[model samples]
Target chain A: MMAKEISKSNYLQIDPWENLRSLSKARIALGNSGGSLPTREVLSFQEDHAFTKDAIYSDLKEKELLKHLQDFKLPVYQFQTKVSDRKEYLKRPDLGKKLAETSESENGDFDILFILTDGLAADAINERAIPLLKEILPKLNDYKIGLCLVKFGRVAIGDEIAEKLNAKFTAVFIGERPGLSSPKSMGIYTTYEPRSETTDERRNCISNIHENGMSIEKAADLLQYFIKESFRRKISGVKLKASLPNQIDRK
Target chain B: MAYKFTLRGKTYSFKDLKTVLAKATPERSGDALAGIAAEDNKERIAAQYCLSEIPLKAFLDDLLIPYEKDEVTRLIIDDHDTEAFKPISSLTVAEFRDYLLSYEVDGKTLKGLAPGLIPEMVAAVSKIMRNQDLISIASKIEVVTKFRNTIGLKGHFSVRLQPNNPSDDPKGIAASIIDGLMYGCGDAVIGINPATDNPQEVSKLLKQLDDFRQQYEIPTQNCILSHLTTTFEIIDKAPVDLIFQSIGGTEKTNSSFGIDLKLLQEAYEAGKELGRGTIGNQMMYFETGQGSSLSADAHHGVDQQTLEARAYAVARKFDPFLVNTVVGFIGPEYLYDGKQIIRAALEDHFCGKLLGLPMGCDVCYTNHAEADQDDMDSLLTLLGVAGCNYIMGVPGADDIMLNYQSTSFHDAMYLRKVLNKRPAPEFEEWLLKMGIFDDQGNRKELKEQMLKLK
Candidate 1:
């Protein structure tokens, strides 16, 4: 049987700059013979999505992350959440926010409490967390600090962690929800006057700190500046503004 | 008998051919050209016919007319071409800005165009210019265009009644629509995003909304924000004014949503075949965002915001009736907080408008994100100044099923009152007829309007 004819007006128009397709990966100026993408691109996108989903589960990296803390010879504590596994952590966000029954409280009057957790992107935490801390830790060598590795945690978990540690400020370096483009992206959320149920406005977030994106030195500089400013201003988030370089010239 | 052809569906026959040529080129009256001479009129008539019937690309070939061409032929032919037909690649940002700010002609030389031809011009031009260059030009040109195909090209807005998962029932959805209309929305286009992707359910929901439009005598358009493929299958069977899809910048991202350019084209064609637009209005409705490409892993290392703009280039292809960016709804991973969200929203609006898409914004954020209504308020006001086409409307600016906060129905009213803008023409008339809006487009008595509904 002859194939059914598709009409011209049924598709998108031809993109005029289709020949310049190689310059950018963005789907621009593609010819307008509109239809679904070909099979290869479709399957590749699906595969990428699967990769993003898999980035959520990286238990093998947990051992290496803890070892890095031990090698730094900094103080470290293991904390558990009310949630049992990553599945529960994702399903019941409320459970992820609370501490486990066996979680013991430790009190230490520290300047900044750095809490590490594999929050949605474990690879982000494993790759960026220690490297970022390593760069900034020396700048604050004189200040008292507490470090803790947390499991199945959320951004708010830092508030409770800081309350128990009795820290002046809290910086939670957690893996952000991975995007298809950058699955190993990390976020550093800091808050002042740390306590449970603190409104998000009191928190400042610095995100997209991965190997390919924001460098460790810059991330470290930002986190240190935020902590210093948080202490100086007695607040974070909307109240305090981070000043950027006035001039930039891209190479 | 001289010659005859149809222009904009009207058959113009030539006996003396004066009136026919006049109809074809209203800018040049037959009498004006007639007094010149009989032979001159014939030459002008043939030129006018080609101008009216042939597209610019085809007409460019006329420059190569094998027979001797003179200065008179060039002046007569080129003068009639809409400035939009100029090879946009040669124009600098300033020149492009000037072209977009106003028609750049003495009068409405572009009156005879099919509805949504601006998209055609934008698509054609965008192909020649870099997206960044186009966006820069669009940003500099602060011109507010009427949604040219519709009544009243002034600033207009719509409230998409999102009857999410738990509230997908017809009665509940109808109640939301009533709630939206009570606050003086439904102007731009009353669209719905069904929580369920089931094609049958989507069709039923569209029918239900169409019934409400008829029962309430709503003069505006309606749609179900489902995937185009789902809508395409049911386009022939449903009362769909627009086919909706969540478009992104790359083919992979679009394909991830189970749609490709071919599917989008098919939907466009189907909507056209169904006579989706009231007149010749374009019939595609697309929603885009910054992180969707990254979310789908198709961003190819491009920044999320730039990817969002390129998606507009894709949207301009179909000459969409609406292209909205659900800016902050994607969560904190892409656009981390209020500052980032606000910046991205403004950029999305700016980029979309510059690309010549009828740009709207779902000025929204998720509970998980560190954003508040105040952030939305600031963005909404800014978008109004930037000439956004519309913004989403939900009850209290919150979608319970979708788990996000968006601009509320009252927000639309606030924008209209503050900005001194009105809804689309037909919806504006309905508002006046229902006594919801006064002649000045202010709320007459919204409490009374609600009470009447009760």
Candidate 2:
């Protein structure tokens, strides 16, 4: 049977050359960091055995500022436009940045924060977020109340709230840009010792968590490591990236 | 005038597309486009009525693959299936460096076969395909896309309609899977295993398919890949094919004999009532399960009996575009396992011979999933001796490299020459070299066997 090929909004020409430059070298290269970091000390063995490999994903921070994150959990309140139109989701990312009034009042404070959003393919949230959530939440229970858990409908990152709350770290679980093969895949990113000021570059990510990619258990473990290392070194991004390992394995 | 309000959460908005299009097109007469428009409207309405929905663009993007390659008949195995297992990720430059050294693979070699990795899989799969191969091969990637269809301006694979809550939405799920397969597969016929148990859901599926066919350009999705992609459709009509999943089996919903007879009746009545009706034109498929049941003594397994009965019933039923294939139980694994390929082929062969209908073909076991590697290879050479015209199995299901430059078989040789340069030797060899190229595209001896069955 025949079907229609509906067009979605993508400003491919917005800065075609720059887009290519960004997608390639910039997206792949670690800024100042060469993947070097202090050894993370797990306070409890109870927190071990989390996240499998396939469940990893990452993204650029929404804002451009940076800060050292001492703590992270979530209350980076999630807010989204009331509109359900796909065009609006793409056009009004600002709506995705704010915290709903009710969500703000209900959300508790935290040294860390987590926000879950239905980025491009909301269908992937379970494959990507559920496990990370399951693993990270229990581990973080030892800390202050985690960021308020609220679901939003777009692609804004955690920095918007961190900038407002002056929190230490920001973590967000969202969908990866849909791929021909992996449309409904999910990802999670976190910045160590984050402030409301951290930009996309300050965090690391774990992606491709479908039955076809990394599983959730591994994604959680990766996030756990990112958080521990972030807290320990008081840094993330190019500072921690330049001299880390021999090979990358997001195969 | 009545204004239409559709359910938004679960639909792809094809309705909106149609509505807006209709408003713009302004049909010659309202009544003229009513039937076509009404049908499209129904599917759209169903999608919108849901509380959640899959994005229509996703499905359409996928559907484009099959539409583009409607003439190629080859089977595809995407390396991406294996690549999803890799262990690296990033956001910034520093993170990428860290990703490279994120963890130790515990001294695993990138060489030799082991488990799966995500990027390598996608890379490997992409490596196997050339730009030319796009329309010639029927691909089976690991992504969720299942089949081809239209959404708006173009055709694409349908998106999966996953509901956060599991309460219901079988049609959406079913439609999404069909779309996924259609999108992922090359211009080969696509099919998906239904996600729901509802009998009515199957009908909705058929209606959607018919609607898709009615709305968009659908080239024949058959080709070398049909030998195997054909199996996907057979399995999809399980009430019809599960009867063949095992030999001699029965399912509650699809009584092979019953469905066939119903179709035959419909064809007969339609033919008499009008100038045209699908007699053999509607559609029927060849189905055979894993070789274990190829040669049964007497429809014995409860599952076996049911399947055989269903198979027999379907064959004798409406008798549309028909084909029947039995496992080519000649491989080595069948020696260890039990694949009466010869016996089953002959039985099905004999059945076809007597009925004077579509021919019956025999196949060798291929999938490592079905048998061991060497065993599948051993069966390939013997297919000639089995007196079967068709062989069904993917290439490299047996051998690591798919260099079929030597074979005289159609699909096998075609793929061998066509897929000769594929970098991923194992999958290309298995899907193309061993299965489609040999079964549908070439093979004189097998052709003779088919004649015998016919």
Candidate 3:
């Protein structure tokens, strides 16, 4: 049998800064046995690697998700972009940025288009998207809202979805890129008059929505405030700044 | 192949050295430096001066006794006419010193020298000037000696204002620089790293910085982080105070940056030919990180910490004025988070200093990395204790362009107060002259001075 060649550095037994390792989960203090990552962290890193991969490639359960939408009395529209499968969606970003020609929304006219997308981290959208939307919808009662459920989509896909819906603003709740520590983090990207021409500057981002991140109630309140401010100013992103109720408005 | 010598219990090497010599100054003439060593004795001269502070002219005149004028003239007259040696030999010891100090070689003077000489001269100097601590080669690069006085001949703890971005306008960059200066940053050099790699864009930025320096009469060096080759291409068109490059631990890792030992030697020569240092000073600003080799997939199976120390060995070969290890910037694949970052930073500083390089820490973290300002605070304080040469001075410690957190201009002020340190000598003079800070470093009238620029 061939000898197994280890990829990591040799593990050392004692590291000088091992005492300082207590402050963080970062790999610094793991005393290298010979000269590399300790066996436990190597295994732990491999496990986290598998966990992040599963979170990114996992698909949403359509029937169970639709049940939550029905329970909230939120009308949902299922849509796809030009990219047909998850593989193509990951490979071709431009395809993910536009809607498929056959796609159409029943509720086309609204003040805002709310989209929940499975971007890179599908498990995050499957677990946290609906509950956060349920809390956010009540606070956004002042505006006419349309809901779109997107599959194999990214944040930019919402720009095309909102353009088709003829909504003035778009709030895209999508899964963020999974970090080793936080696999299920979500992000909200809000844009005014989003279109193919829209750049990142036209969209405002609020991120890190998960159990370990921003709570659903706080994200809902913040999203409501941003949407309200975008409507009042007729702008978002670089031009409009977000402020808490207790803070002074920069504008 | 290691031409190693130890000073203060630490060893240093002078391998593949080309630009480690001192520039000509009024106190030391460029011709005298050229005469001190010939092509045959480069290592001998380096080993001799690597651990002693006796001025070269003094070493030759007083210490190098019974020296034949013809033999010395043979060594000194490289390209110059041998008749040039006639005036040099007849002079008394003091007159020879005066002649060497007073003469200018190609519009420049030599303040200090690392002359390439024979083993005989190296032995002579070593036998005579056996000072315990060889004054750092960095101090000899410039004429003014006060810059290294406070740190006891070690390089001062300094900060470089890194006003970075692609679309950053001149006015915006200037504001950040002013903010840093007001808070006692930019002692090392006020440098900018433009997001775009275009040579024209980088040259334009250097032009604006030169204009700013001239307008304020700022008495420190400036740079834009362009590859040394790119800098060589543009230095003729624009002024660059230092040739900036990022080096790594392994030869393979350095190769990934399109650099090798030969390229480094060539870049050093190119920088010297350009002569961009602020009036005959050393001209190299290098950055390294612990995880950079592993991040670049060139760790070569050696551990990250040992690889980082090897990078310092490369840096000291050129005797750079600044070599900053941007600790924690590479992120989690190598150094996981704050704890790792803190440990690696101290290690980098300790290792760089041990190798006789003026080591600094970026003391930075990215948002994606599990780090925050508090981690930077702890690391900065610790590195301060470790005698860090410098840290990054980004406004608010937040780089809007890179979206990373580093030490702010305010953090530098805090370090200065707590550690009883100040910026490099010239910058301290500027601060005191501007009346922004007092003799005790108390704020005299910040709003009045800073608002005037805006």
Candidate 4:
């Protein structure tokens, strides 16, 4: 009698939803082998995780970023927070929120101060900050603007810098927490009359600014709208609800 | 009152009950960040020793947060079941740990004792116990709940198929739901953490999930994890099954989340009035983590773990169907690493189970944290052995929307296979009918099941 022949493909179970992968970037329709994920899918997931980790730990290329910021024709100031390094930054968020005692402050009368910081993901700031600034700076040309970049800083750090500068408003460009799919996403937080004690409810946030999410141009447009409305109403954050054309006159 | 303990000829003193609890907690980064962690291992041990001698009844008398100031504290004090606490009222914290681990205290006994114990008492006993002690005691207590299908029964495992999409796209959510169902997940519920909190957007996503769930006749409920106020606004208009909220331990923390006891009570009554469940009416679903109170600047000099247990006290009051600790989703600032995350997960599960809540874990980690997939595997296995009610089933262990890694559908399958656990009985019968699993409770080949779902 002939020996029985068995096929190795019998063990692999491919889901029909594989075709639906185009609808979203979510990791779905990964075929399985005996109820566990296939080797290729598992390795791909690990690879993405490794990349995300790299993006988080990577430094914000300060020299390159400074060169790009200079092109905006605005004076750039550099500072550091109380956080000494990456390790300390992750462990002590309070330290990241405070300005370092050694860092020099500049007192300026400005309408809006733009502050940039390397938050949880430095690569986000390294890549997207300049592009977003390019889109936003020209729109705010009528107002007096001050630009500054701080290392090892959190979003709230901008409040202290802006407060020292005597700026009427503060717009912060910081790196958001890196997701697996989007490592270079940036966020914009704009606060009116930013003081050291300003809370989160006192700011308006526009998040997920990246190639795949909200484009830089769109984020710039939204930031411009917020600045104009906030300056007009002398308010920001939760109280500054987006007003439609009809609702604008009522407010 | 100040408490002190002499250990190895060195004296460690804590100024108050909150200080003692904070120092007694295991070394996690959150406490250190708050500047309240024990100075050294010896100091931690000293605090634990001092805590062990305190009587269980002292927790009732000496409150952590003053009852007059915090509604959560007042709720705990008002809800104390002195009748039920009669069994273990006289035991010290150390003896309470031993009593819980004793073979004499089984599931039914734990159910009876749950009403008598407060979060602080459970949190204190947990500090003195080892990891195995946490797991072994938690394994004996089963907290069964129901909305459509019963959950937390012994030898039964469940997964809350997340199926989250970044933009809340209907097709993408549907695709993930199908994938999870083919892998024999979604026995708990199909919960979506929507990208937008806009009321219209939330309503659209909730309607989509409800439509798909009703279309397939799946024996499960669906929820949109939006803010509670958003849910309340749309609950009357949409097909709301389980109201979802992210509650914290302290009154201020809940305030930061834009909630209070009155708001929670309103949402609870709104969910109950919906009258959507067929099998049971446990309508509330809550998600919590260790460091929420601290993150909101509301920890009140208390440790994260103790505050986390207090959040469970809030959950138990509403009689939620499912309460999950999204353990490692809070970053390294709170948990630090895999070891801390694992310890927090075990402690949260143990405390919640003892408090008579059906506890699940989102065995997850952010990329920034000093953790990896291996840590998640260890936690998943340990929770499985501890008889955790459910774990999250994200697509391929990566939540693109939330930007974190959680337990996947395959991880749920792995847990069921290794532990010989099956899905909720009603869900398993549906799976059998759908040909996802055989009568022997083993998963079948998925090609046909995929086609059926497609």
Candidate closest to the true structure, highest lDDT: 4
What are the TM values for chain B, all candidates?
Answer: 0.69, 0.31, 0.66, 0.99
Candidate 4 or 2, higher TM-score: 4
Error of 1 at A241 (Å): 48
**Candidate 1 structure quality by residue, lDDT tens digits, A1-251:** 99999986455333232343333222222221222233444455457556655666765276777888887677777788898876556545556677888878777888888899888777788777888888988899777887888888988889888877788788998887665456677888899988885755567777656543456776777778788888888988645555533111111
Question: With candidate 1 superimposed using the best TM-score fit, by how many Å does residue B175's alpha carbon deviate from the native?
Answer: 1.6
Model 3: CAPRI class? incorrect
Provide TM-scores for the models. 0.50, 0.26, 0.48, 0.93
- Candidate 4: C-alpha RMSD after superposition: 3.5
| Fraction of true A-B contacts recovered by candidate 1 | 0.00
Q: Candidate 3: where is the Cα deviation over 4 Å?
A: A1-251, B1-156, B449-454
Top TM-score prediction, candidate number: 4
| Candidates in order: C-alpha RMSD to true structure | 25.6, 29.4, 20.6, 3.5
Model 4 lDDT at residue A211: 59
After TM-score superposition, the amount by which residue A111's alpha carbon in candidate 4 deviates from its true location, in angstroms, is 4.9
Instruction: Judging by lDDT, tell me the better candidate of 1 and 3.
Output: 1
Please state the error at residue B358 of candidate 2 in Å: 53
The TM-score ranking, best first, is 4, 1, 3, 2
Q: Which pairs clash in the backbone of model 4?
A: none
Q: Which tens-of-lDDT digit does each residue in B1-454 have in candidate 2?
A: 1123354443334333223222222111111212322234454334223211222222222221142332110011132223422332212222322222334321132221112222111111211222222111111111111112111011111111111101113333223222222111112222323322123433344454445433433322221111111223333332221111211222222221122233334433442332211211323334543222222211122122112323443343434233444443322222222233333333343333222223334344322112322333343333322222223322111111110111112222322233222211222232243222232222222222232211
Candidate 1 stretches with Cα past 4 Å from truth are: A1-251, B1-152, B155-165, B446-454
